[model samples]
Every structure is written in C-alpha cells, then in structure tokens.
Target: MMKRLAMVFVGLMLIVGNAWAVPDGIWKNITGAPAYSFYMQTYVGNAMLVIVAPNTETFWVFLDADDNYTNGFSASQDLSGAPNSLSITFTSDGSALANMTLTGQLPATYNLSRNAQAPSTGDSGDAPTLISPADGETIAVPTSASPYSMTWTAVTGAEGYIVQICTDNSCTNVISDDNGDWTSTGTSISLTHATAGFDFYWRVRADLGGGSYSPWSEIRRFHVSSS
Candidate 1:
C-alpha cells in the first residue's frame, strides 16, 4: 500500500529557486525622496519568453538586518505599470533597509525598474538643542584679587550657561589659565582669575545644548591689575 505525506515551508515568505529575478541590469526611475517611502511599478518581464503566471504577482523590496522588509509587498502589480522606480532610506545598522521586493514570481528574463537614485538619508534624528550661557558671577577686570570677566548675549535654546576666562589672547588655554582665583554665579555668567598686572583678552559665547559649548565670542580684551 502507498502512504500520503504533508510538508511545510515558511516565511521571509520568499518562494526561492522558483521566482524569476531580473538580471543585475540597470533599470531607471526618477529621483528624490518624500518624508516616507514611495512606490513604483515597472514591468518585470521579457514579454517574448514568459507570461506572468495566472494569479501570480511580482514585487520589488528592501530589507533590514533582521531580514524584515522596509516596505511590504504590493498588490495588483502589473508588468505594464509605469514609473518603475522609487527612493528609500535605512538605518545605519541596516536594521531597517528600505527595499523593493517582488512576490508572485516574475517571468524568466524579466526586468525590475529601479530608481536612478537609490534611497538616501533616513528619517531625521532627534531635534538638536542649545545648552549654555551658564552660571557665574563676579566677573572682574583690572583688579589684583581677581581679574577676567566675560559677557554673552542672551540665549534661548540654551538650558544653562558656561563661562570661561583666560589671561591669554588664545582661548586654547583652559581653566588652568583661569588660575586658582576663580568663581561662578549661575544665571549671569562671569568669572575672575588672579593675574595681576597683565593684559588678558577674553570673550564668551552661549552654549545652546545640554552641556554643549556655543560658538566662541569675539575675542574681547581686558586687563588684570593694569600695567
């Protein structure tokens, strides 16, 4: 006696070894991107050699690192559809690559219309912010106890502020340049560094991000215990 058996295959939903893929040739389409993904349908066929399988379908798709498609399968795709091109984007990790995959197998020797411009930039990242005008007080100049003061324009995006003063023309000099004689006052930015009898140039810029620095201020000038 003969016996009957059943079998199962699954997902990616890919048909494999059966679906016809267009040769790696150049297909063309218009270029640009909308806020989200877009679609285009081009003939994926040879016309002379094969006919689309009855009730068969074709798709163009992209995938992610997890093998998930960026855009899903399209329904009612026809070999005669026009503007067979599109644009898309993906994450850096490729975990979300935009694609154009076709299903319902195409006729052998068919073509996949491709957009001249592949996908470009992904969704915009988190909004940026400005952080500092910072906290400080008692910014002094032309004094012995302390010397060095800086003022910055008001900031809007800034969450807070940071003020730095130095006795040198070049700002490359850090806190060490401020010397042991220094102080801060939070809201209104200011500082005083002990550098008696020396002419020091200074300036301040508002930092507009959470702990980020703003563009440096025009180098302002001042003196410590004046010459």
Candidate 2:
C-alpha cells in the first residue's frame, strides 16, 4: 500500500504554527426561528471550518491567512436563525474532547484567514445616517503628504465599506482605496492618493453583511492641487 505525502509550499514556514482553536464560546440551540438566531457577519478567507459536537446541526466559519490576532485568542459565532444556543467543542491534536457549553450557537472565523468583510444585506427597509465630511464637496489633500484620510457617516450594521474615486464627475465603478490610494484608517477608509494636477471625484458606501449595500451617499469630489 502506498501512503500519500502532503507537499509543503514555500512561505508556509513563516506561518506554520500548530493550528490552535480560539475558544470563542459555546452555543445552545440551532435552526429553529428567526430574529433570535445568533446572527453575525464574518469575512471569509483561505478555508472554511464547520465545527460540530454531539447535538445541533453543524455550523460554518471562515478565516483569512492575513489576520492579526487581537483581543486574545477568541472566537465568535453567528446564530441569526438559532432559536437557542448549544454546547460544542473544537479539537486540534494531542488533546481530549473539550468540555463545551454554550447558548446561541456562534460561528468563529480566524481573522488572518478572513478578509475584513462588509456583507450586503437585502433591503431591510432601514437607513443609517452618515456623520462625517459633507458629501459633494471639494476637499484638499494636504500638500506634500504621502497619505490622507477621509471621514463619513456610518451606516447601521455595516460590516465594511468600499471607497471609490474617479477623475470624472459622472464616472461609475469605484475601486477599493485599500491599496493606500487615500491613506485611510479604521472605519474611516482612505482616499488621499491622486495624480497631481488632476481633479477627482469620490464616493463611499457601507456594505452590510449577507448581500446588501446602503444607498450610495452623496458623492464627494476632491482635488490634488499641484505643488
């Protein structure tokens, strides 16, 4: 009989640590009703993991390869449709089954393996008020600055946001400013990178989890004046 050997790729050495499960929490019930299910929005990454124990239907979680561990080795689950919570356990290696207890089933995804995500929610018939830079106004990028930041009103239940820019006022299809085009931070994404001596138009929208986007906010235009 021949044994199968896994091929290890390069660059896997740096991040090749034992796969440890972060203890998010145990849940109680799964699959029953709505409005009470442990609902959460998570960014999917390299792999998707579903953990199951003795009872309850298996759940799903996603993780990215570029996550920075924060708030300790913790995890969370979404039980949006769960009528209650359930007890669960995760196993890696060289360990006995975990003593698990939880309510409101939670799905935990590792940030490194998951891209920070803002899901699109269907028209839930609710609107959020934005609370930063006035829309449709011309702003200036600090002279001689490598990066700049933009601010705006936050939409309710937004998982993430997308910022787009164009030189033409009537242009559509906004590109992500995540590549440092605008030098953004936190909930306020960046929008400072621009070709000098060019007038630019910009717009931003919040992405709620699932498959919904908030109505596009009023457009904003800024210019990168030449030195």
Indicate the residue-level lDDT of 23 in model 2: 30
Worst 10 residues of 1 by lDDT: 46-55
Tens-digit lDDT track of model 1 for 1-227: 11111211111122211223222222221122111122223222211111112111222232222222223223343334333331222112222222233334232222334333322111111222212212322223434454333444454455544444555667556454334423233334334335556554545444333222344445545544433
Candidate 2: residue 217 Cα off by (Å): 0.9
RMSD of each: 20.9, 17.3
Q: Model 2, poorest ten-residue lDDT window? A: 9-18
- lDDT against the true structure, per candidate, is 0.32, 0.37
lDDT of 2 by residue, 157-199 (tens): 7777656566677645444444533322235754445566666
lDDT for position 98 in model 2: 20
Alpha-carbon runs more than 4 Å astray in model 1: 1-150, 176-187, 190-192, 210-213
